[model samples]
Every structure is written in structure tokens, then in C-alpha cells.
Target: MEPNGMKCAWFQFLIGFEIMSLGAYFPMKVYVYTHDFEEGGKENPKKIHFARIPVIGECIVLSNNPNWYKVVLVLHTPYMAADADAEVWCVKITGSAARKAAGYSAS
Candidate 1:
């Protein structure tokens, strides 16, 4: 309702969208995969099973309002006894001694 008897389209449009709080923490569930990188390809029985994935820290959030997280942390969930490899990942990782002999070089 307006002075001219017309609805305010701009006001209605602004109300339709939602804004997310920047620094909010929420709980979420993550998948745990078995440490079976052998024969690396899709459709392996080892990869099919899903188990409890514990979160030692709060890198995830669960909210009723949809959020858009620009930076995503996609984990190729490791089967290690614990998430200890996180430290090693921050450093340089090396392959077999014969990696260069096998025809792979650092670019």
C-alpha cells in the first residue's frame, strides 16, 4: 500500500535475500574413509564405507540459514589412526626415492 495504491517492489525484493554472520561457529558431520589409496580409482569397496569422523577443531558450521563459504576445505579423508598428517601437509611432502626415475619431475 502506497500513496498511489501500488506495492513497493524495491522493498519486497530487498526482504527476499538473507545475509550470513561472518564469524559464526556451527556443528557438522564429516565422512571418514579407509586408508586404501592402492589401485586409485572410483568404485572401490574400501571407499564405499562411511564411518564416524571426529572433529577435533571447529572448521565447520551448521546453520538453518544457508551460507556461502568462499574457501572450502575438501578432505580426501585419510584412514590414518588420527589426523596427525595435518602437520606434515603444511610442510613439503616427498614420494619414493625412484620418483624421478619413474618419470615425474617437480615443475
Candidate 2:
């Protein structure tokens, strides 16, 4: 796997959440599909099989904590792929003082 893919897998394992497939590498931004898992946390192969809904964001460097990260995701409207309106999301992982402050989990 590529280094980013490895990092994605590690992040997935560390947080017990699926790492949605990402778009091409962009400086400071990573694009990801959001519907890879079902409401109950099970992998939804059907969703994976269908169209992808990608969102973009920058992940903060976690120099002090190798096991966690913080991502600021900018989501599009209708929560679909390329809807064009943006919404900022602050996601805190294991190291942050904010502590995953967003009430919602990775979708």
C-alpha cells in the first residue's frame, strides 16, 4: 500500500472507523467518500458498490501523538459529491484537547 493508504488504514484501526476512499493527492486537502459504513457501524458493501460521495479537508499534523489526528473537513451541500456549498467540520481524535468535540462520528 502507499504511505497515505497505510496511514489511512492505521487511522481506521486506531479509531475503529472506516477510512473512506479518497480522491487524488492534493496539497493540504484529502478527499473522502462518506457512506462506506452503515448506521450500525457495519461495512456497507452496497454503498461501496454504488456511487461515491466525496468530501475534502485538511488533516492537522499530530507530531505529539502518532496514533491520532485532527481533520477539518469541508463538506458539500446535500452531502453528496460536488454539491459546491461548503461547511467546515472540526474533528478531534485521541490527542486533541477538544476531544472529538463534534457530536457526530465519522459518517
Candidate 3:
């Protein structure tokens, strides 16, 4: 094969490989919360319990916000409900609302 023709073929192969690899990668990010924060619960000092704890790979939202998140980790201390802390983690879903299958409602 001619040198120029070989270079063109290699470039095309690289583009195809990159496109396929994108589906396997996560977006790089560093999150920082604003000074405005909500108390984690309704009562005094926000001691709280979750009625339905989210499992890994579940989608959830924070409060009444429209934003959606995919649950990544949940470390529940069943004894800590009466304490002042709770833990949950999720990856933010940008530009997409929660799926109906994730149990969100229009109302």
C-alpha cells in the first residue's frame, strides 16, 4: 500500500476505535457544593430515616428537584436513624429526567 493510503486507513481506524471506547468511559468531574445547603430532614437537627433506601444501580433524586441521579453506593447504618448523619451516593444525570421505570411520577 502507498504511504498516504496507509496513513488514511490508520486514521479512520483510530476514529472508529475512539467512538466505540466512549461508551465504556465515565465523564471526569470534581464536585463542590454551594454554601446554600438544606438540612437533611424535617425535624430538629435533621435526625432522619429513609422509608425506602436506594440500592446500587438505582436512580434517585434529591428532595423535590427535577434532577436525576444513578445510585452508585449506599452505606446504611440501620442504627443511625436517630443520629445526625446519613450517607448516599449517585452520579448526576445531565439533560435527562428520571425514567418512569425508576418510580418517578409526573405529579
Which ten-residue region of model 2 has the weakest summed lDDT?
A: 42-51
Ordered by lDDT, highest first, the candidates read 3, 2, 1
lDDT of 1 by residue, 6-85 (tens): 45665555555322321132222343222212335222111212123233321221234332111122354345573322
Model 3 ranges off by over 4 Å = 1-49, 80-86, 95-107
| Candidate 3 colliding pairs, count | 0
lDDT of 1 at 6: 41
**What pairs collide in candidate 3?**
none
Candidate whose TM-score is highest: 3
Candidate 3 local lDDT, 1-107, one digit each (tens): 57998999999999999876763563212121211124342222122244445577766555587656666665554453333223555656532355554566634
How many backbone collisions does model 1 have? 0
Q: What TM-score goes with each of the models?
A: 0.17, 0.17, 0.37
- How well does model 2 score by local distance difference test? 0.37
Give all candidates' CA lDDT scores: 0.28, 0.37, 0.50
What is the per-residue lDDT of model 2 for residues 7-99, given as tens digits with 9 covering 90 to 100? 988887866542332322212222322231224433211112112333333334323544333434555455446423343333434434434
